[model samples]
Each structure stands twice: as structure tokens, then as C-alpha cells.
Target: MFSKLFKSQSALRRFYSTATQNLTEKQEPKTYYKITLLRSAIALPKRYKDTLVTLGIHRRMQTVFHPHKPDIAGKILRVKELVQVENVPASAVRTKTEQRWERRPDPGFEVVGTWKNKRWLLDEEGI
Candidate 1:
């Protein structure tokens, strides 16, 4: 009975790993590391902050993308606890200007001759 259970567990593990592999194979290949800083490295060792600097992250919640290379992966692991990482395809990478445009707040509209504005003016005039 123990042999049967162990065999089943091994098979299940294999199935789980293969299923994830198949999904990745079907989807667009991940070529970039989307690294977003979630926590500050302040009060931590200088090495931690320096790793972030090397990765071009200066502020909390800042995101940067690097190619999926061994050295870049190592740097990411060094500060893994302070960041959120996602495997993104090359097309998902954006330029600095694009990121700024996406981050900027939407332009607001002017309230032109609305009923609320007219009511406010009349109220001030003792209407």
C-alpha cells in the first residue's frame, strides 16, 4: 500500500510540473523580468540597496525590466523579499516615457455653466 501511494504521489508531482510547462509553451515566451519594488531597503544593509540601484530601482514601487539572464536573475534573487516579479514577454517592456505617460493622472475637465455652479452664484446673491 505504501509503495502504491508513493508511486501515485510521484506521478502527481510529474503531472503538475508538466502541466505548468505546457501552459508556458502555449503562451508567449517570457523574455523579460518585470521587477517592481514593493518594500523599501532603508535600514537594511547597503548591499541590499546597492543591488536595487544596479537594477535601476530608486524609489519604492518603481518597476524596471531586465532581460532574463543569469546575472539579472541573481540580482533579483538578492532583493527578492523587497520586490514583486513577473515574467513578461519582450513586447510588454515599455520605454521610460511610456511608463511616465501611463503613470500620469488623467487630465481633468472644466465645469462649464453647470446647474450646481449657477445655484452657488444665486445663493451668494441672496436668492
Candidate 2:
């Protein structure tokens, strides 16, 4: 049972890894900007709010991906104190739905050894 489970897990991992590589290759460049809003612009100057708007960040914790360019870099610098910025590949970017899905917790338990795989408990002394 354990072997079957392991084999399935490995297959899933392989499939996802290759799929991820394809996705990245098709959508992302070697380098890009990952901008996440860490602080809100409320009660701040108009410039900060305008900058955030220009960067396409609407609220706190919102993340936006942009290409690495002089104009974008300058905008980031201008609002450096209000946001967290990182250089990431296009593959790292996630849409709103994807981000929400990723934030969800796992269901907890999973089936492992089954009746057909009694060999999984071979080393156990008291079964």
C-alpha cells in the first residue's frame, strides 16, 4: 500500500514540476519585479496613493508583477517604504484565485498503506 502511495506521489510531483517549467518558460522572462503592498496609503500623502495606483496595487497585501524596466524600477523606489519588492521569475506570479487557493490549508489526513500493501508494516513488532 505504501509503495503504491509513494509511486503516485512521485508521479504527481514529476508531472507538476514539468508543467511548472513549461508555464514559466512560456510566460516569464529571466527576471521580473514582484511587488507586494505591505502598507496602506491611507492618511498618507497623495503622492503615495498615486504611486500605488500607478503600480496597479489597490490595497494592502495585494501583489503585482511587472517587467524589469527603468520606469518600473523608479516607481518602486518612489514607494519603497510602502511596499515589499522582490526580483522574481514570471513563474512566481500568481493570480488572485491561485493565491487564494494556495493560502488554503490542506485537508489534513491522507490514505497511506492499504490492505493490499501489508508489506508496509514489515518492520513493526506489534501489529
Candidate 3:
């Protein structure tokens, strides 16, 4: 009975290990850091707040991107509890303007002009 239990547990462990290996191997190497401040550093130690500033995070729930470098990783570790970090590819990087543009609501239709101006333009075109 003891031998049978050990064999089954060992088989299950092997399966899980291979499954984890496959998951890690299938992913591309991440080149960028996507860090978001989840919790506020308010009332925390000055060093924690300073680390957040060094990471360019000044507000809660704000996200910033940095290259995947050891220095940045160390800084992230310093405030890990107050922030969330994700690995991202270089192509996923965006500037502030691009990020803001993405948040804007899309207008349903294109507005060439009002009917009066559109009619005037149409009449003047001799069409």
C-alpha cells in the first residue's frame, strides 16, 4: 500500500513539473517592465515612497513602463508590496500621449461639417 501511494504521488509530481516547464518555455523573453502602483505609499517609510518616485509612479493605480534591467528590478523588489509588476515585450511600450489617446471614447461617425457648410462646399464645387 505504501509503495503504491508513493508511485502515484511521484507520477503526479512529474506531470506537474513538466506542465510548468512547458508553460515557461512557450513564452517569449520579456524585454520591458509594466509596473503599476497598487497600494499607496502614504504613511509608509520614506524609502518606500522614494522608491515609487524613482520608478516614476506618483499616484496609486498608475502604471509605468521601464526596460527590463537589473537595477529596475531591484527597485521594484524594494516596493513589491505596494505595486504590481508584469513582464511585457518592447512592442507593448507606449508613450503618455498614446496611452491617453487609447482612453478617449471613439466617435460613432466622422463629422465632415454641418449640413449648411457641407451644402455650401458641395454647391461651390460645381458638382
Candidate 4:
């Protein structure tokens, strides 16, 4: 019985170590980049925002990667009036991208629903 228990314990230890290794392996190394959102697409016509969106940027602070090319550099310069470009590591860029993707939806819907239901019920009861 003791030998069986020892074997089981060893199995458990191996399983735990394998699970930890799997977790570590799934983690992506971070990528960072210098980013700038060159256009005030918000102020420009919707076409500009659509163009920026096509380029993988949406909101004002949104950023996308472009290998340093003359065309990209030129676009950055044109948008320089609106955006502040900076050099950053690929890892930092990856972290920021992950963070933006992981962001939760706004709580406004739940808040409005609760408030409307509570207010309606209270009014109906003459409270």
C-alpha cells in the first residue's frame, strides 16, 4: 500500500510540473513599438476615420505598427499635427495591444437598466 501511495504521489508531482510548464509555454513574449496616431480622424471626415480604421487604428489614442518606410513616415508627419509618435520596444507594444483587447465593455447599460427599473417600481408604488 505504501509503495502504491508513493507511486501516486510521484505521478501527481509530475502532472503538476507539466501543467506549470504548459502554462508558461502558452504565454506570448511582449512586443513593443513606437506608435503615433497621425490623423485627427475625429475632426476629419468619416472617410479619414474609416481609412485609419482600415489601417488598424480606431480611437484617438489607438496605435498600429508600420515598418519604418518613407510612405508610413510621411503619413506620420502629416498627422504630426494631431499625434505624438514615439519609439517604444516591441514588448511594450504587445502589452498595450493585449490590454486594449482585454478591456471590458462599458457599464452604462447595466447602470441605466437598474436605475430605470428601480425608479419605475418606486413610482408605481407611490413611494
Candidate 5:
């Protein structure tokens, strides 16, 4: 009875592992956008930051939008010496420095023994 129970448990574990592996094999595409800073507010008055704030761009690399109108273009051009402007899409917007990945230690410890016992165990009782 114990042998049969163990065999069934192993089969279920194998099925779960296979399903997880299949899911991990799929890849997804990512979208990007173009942006530029038209004004160089870095050396300008604090009011410049206010202007950028009004435009929804408060940070150095922040990107915002204005309708593609001549007036908007003119304003951008007027401040061109201070900032850069570019085409940015909604899909590309994310929190600053959000692309970083964290490194983690392996979840399993190294084992060296028979199929039933793990080397990390303190004693033959399986700890």
C-alpha cells in the first residue's frame, strides 16, 4: 500500500513539473516609445520646473504629451534650448528604474545521496 501511494505521489509531482515547464517556455513582447527633453531646465529658474510640472514632466527624464498642435509645437520649440521632445507611447511609460531584476539564491540545497535521502540531512532518520 505504501509503495502504491508513493508511486501515485511521484506521478502527480511529475505532471505538475511538466506543466510548469511548458508555461515558462512562452515569451511575451514588450513595447517602447520615443521621448525628448525640449527645455534645459537644469540651469534655469525654479519656475522652469513649474512649467514642466504643468506639462506633467517634473523629473529629468519624465515624458508628457501635448496635442500635436502648432501652438504646442511652437512652445516646445521656444524651449528647445532647455529640453528635448520626442514621441512617447502609453505602453512604454513606467516608474523610473523599473527594469531592474533582483538576484536570489537557489531555493534548493545541494544533495548527495541515494534517491530517498538528502545529504543535507543531519542523520539517517531524515531529520
Candidate 6:
């Protein structure tokens, strides 16, 4: 029947739209750097320590994301012996807070309080 055919076509359209949306979300920005400190620069030359600091890596095993650029590439090359570098997609980068949130374990219990209810406590304490 024409109605059945029309329904299938509509479903196909919805499927195609969803697929395209997922593809777009997966698409990454032009270029990015995934820099991980493999070795510490302790006791090394001051230049090495300065380079690591410039790259935003504060310690060994720390990973930082940066945009791919000639200056950054030059800096990486300067301390290649102290780090492992790779190209990564933008979505792979995460902020410190996001990393903490990801590592946090969910509590089985829920917080059952509202600002309105707590307002009285604050008022009584003159806070």
C-alpha cells in the first residue's frame, strides 16, 4: 500500500538524519596536540624545565592538549626526550574539572535539600 511505503520512507529519512548528526559530532577540529610527559626533567638543564613549564605539563605522566602550531612543535622537539607527543582530535581534550568529574564515583544516595529550605537556617544564624 502507498501508506506503508510512505511510512518506511519517513523512517529512512529519520535514520539518515540521526546518522548525519552522529557523524558531525564525531568530526574533529583541524589539528591538535596530545602531549604526555614520559620522564621528569628534574636535575636536567634549566632550559628543559622551562620548556616543560611552557608546555603546561607540571609533572611526569601528566597529559595536556594544545593546538598544533610551529612554536609548539619546536618546543616539543626541544624536549622530545622528556615527552611523548601525538596528534589528537579536539573532542579528546578535557579540562581539569571534567577529568575530576569523570573520576568521581557516584554515591548511592541523593542530596535532598533545596535553597529555599536552607534559607531559614542561614537567616537564623545571621549569615
Q: Count the backbone clashes (under 3 Å) in each candidate.
A: 0, 1, 0, 9, 11, 0
CA RMSD (A), model 3: 12.7
Overall local distance difference test of candidate 5? 0.58
**Residue 119 local lDDT, model 6:** 65
Higher-TM-score candidate of 1 and 5: 1
> TM-scores of the models, in the given order?
0.62, 0.58, 0.67, 0.39, 0.34, 0.62
- The 0-to-1 C-alpha lDDT of every candidate, in the order given, reads 0.92, 0.87, 0.88, 0.62, 0.58, 0.88
TM-score of 5: 0.34
Give the Å error, residue 110, model 5.
Answer: 24
Model 2, 1-127: lDDT tens digits are 9999999999999999999989968676657788999989899889989989999999999998888899999999999998998888877877778989999999898865677886557536445
Q: Order the candidates by lDDT, highest first — what do you get?
A: 1, 3, 6, 2, 4, 5
Better of 3 and 6 by TM-score: 3
Which digits, one per residue and each the tens of the lDDT, describe model 6 over residues 1-127?
9999999999999999999988986776547889999999999989999999999999888888889999999999999999998887788787767877888998887755567789657767889
Residue-level lDDT of model 3, residues 21-118, one tens digit each, is 88875665679999999999999889999999998989988889999889999999999898899988777887768888988999888765687668
Model 3 lDDT at residue 114: 82
**Candidate 5 wrongly placed segments (more than 4 Å):** 1-35, 38-40, 87-127
Give the poorly placed runs of model 3, Cα more than 4 Å off.
1-29, 114-126
lDDT of 4 by residue, 1-127 (tens): 9999999999999999999987765553323335557446666767656556545666666666655567666666645566666654344455455767768567575432256469766767789
Candidate 1, after superposition: displacement of residue 122 in Å? 39
Cα deviation in Å at residue 10, candidate 2? 18
TM-score: model 1 vs. ground truth? 0.62
Question: Could you tell me the TM-score of candidate 3?
Answer: 0.67
Q: Which stretches of candidate 6 lie over 4 Å from their true place?
A: 1-26, 112-127
